[model samples]
Target: MSDAHTADEGRAPRRVLVVMAHPDDVDYGAAGTVARWTAAGHDVRYCVVTDGDAGAEDPETDRAALAATRRGEQRDAAAVVGVKDVTFLGYPDGRVETGLALRRDVARVIRRCRPDLVLTHSPDRDLVHVKASHPDHRAVGSAVLDAVYPDARNPCAFPELLHQDGLAAWTVPEVWVRGGPVTNHHVDVTDTFHLKMTAIRAHVSQGGQSAEFEETMRARLAALARDAGLPDGRLCEAYLRIDTR
Candidate 1:
């Protein structure tokens, strides 16, 4: 991971696409890193697989309205991290499945974006922290990985994309999996941590309005920085970097 980071440290800005399950997933996992990239002049886009309609605990909540609200919230959140492009796939929040449909849809975005790097959740479950391994997250991860490989790059995998939408095959060079059990890459995000919090705070409907949530996130990031051997007071975001090239 360090070698990879060093290799690309001072390279020209590359396009980055973040694919996530819900509105706030990016803010929770990669907002700080995203801030750094944007500040460095990288192009960034977001493809949210779901609208997070099932996020609320209230049984009587209007799912459709909630979904709309979440989409708006996600757009606002992305703005905080200097990302202006956001695409919502409108998949059911909690019922996302790793299927051909999802793979193809994600592939479409890949071709459209032609991103050099794709950031997503971990397909593998984390038994240590079950709460973080949401089923939808894993599903999106698996689908996106598949899309980045055979589906998006292979011309025959999704022929309709080329024939109908004129989206050509795109091969993503690398992928960074967030919230995975194993992490080999660490981004020193101390400078952008506040932006991360501000992005998360945009998801007010999902408890991001709470000051306690911000403090908790701060503590967690600090702990991660320590684990990554960073000096005290620094903050970081960790990822399992996979080379797809």
Candidate 2:
């Protein structure tokens, strides 16, 4: 669908929840935005669907060890931007699917957090970031979107979560899609850009330490800021703002 936008359509959400596919996913795309939100006293939580076990390049890498390593890295990275609570769903990396089970898991978090704003990858595959729009990313985006809509708002859809888990239904007013192929909204992250880079660099197992990775990210964010019509040297994160409700 083409992006439809209303500039500053509503006030910034007071409570934000970020749900993504893997350990480094949020930091890579929306950490700066998260920093901006937290600095403004908004409550933000991150939910990672995968354990990142399959992120290693070498076949000899231990999958179990890699998953554990990535989890710790995510926590440290989140801390850099004042996000203290992160939930890891522990699904196998590269094996996520957009299905009922995944939807239920994401819905549970939504019901519990009851966030007004949700941030996630584009539900559609992003041609712009071919590598980032992995099978896992697509799956999580689809599931999270499902969770945000009727599922989370309708307790009848997931009775187990309501009856067994005692989590009530929640209505999230809006969802912002990060790294979409088309962008209609942007967050000027000039002040928090350094914090974002620091958070991204915490993912040591995922090339966060590579100079090339850092350089590429800087260039990308700077370009996004320019395209967003921010000051020439400003840094920003772009999104397609989706009003889910």
Q: Which is the leading candidate under TM-score? A: 1
Across 1-245, the per-residue lDDT of candidate 1 in tens digits comes to 33222214476999999999999999999999999899888999999999999999998999999999999999999999899999999999899999999999999999999999999999999999787699999999999999998899999987999999999999999999988789888888888988999999899889776778878888998888888887899888888899998
Candidate 2 lDDT tens digits, 120-212:
988677776787678888788889899988899996998999899999999999988875577788887777878988999899888777778
RMSD, each candidate, Å? Answer: 1.6, 2.9
Candidate 2 Cα deviation (angstroms), residue 164: 0.3
- Using all chains and alpha carbons, the TM-scores for the candidates as numbered come to 0.96, 0.93
Please list the residue runs of candidate 1 whose C-alpha ends up more than 4 Å from where it truly belongs after superposition: 1-9
Q: Top model by lDDT, which number? A: 1
Error of 2 at 124 (Å): 1.3
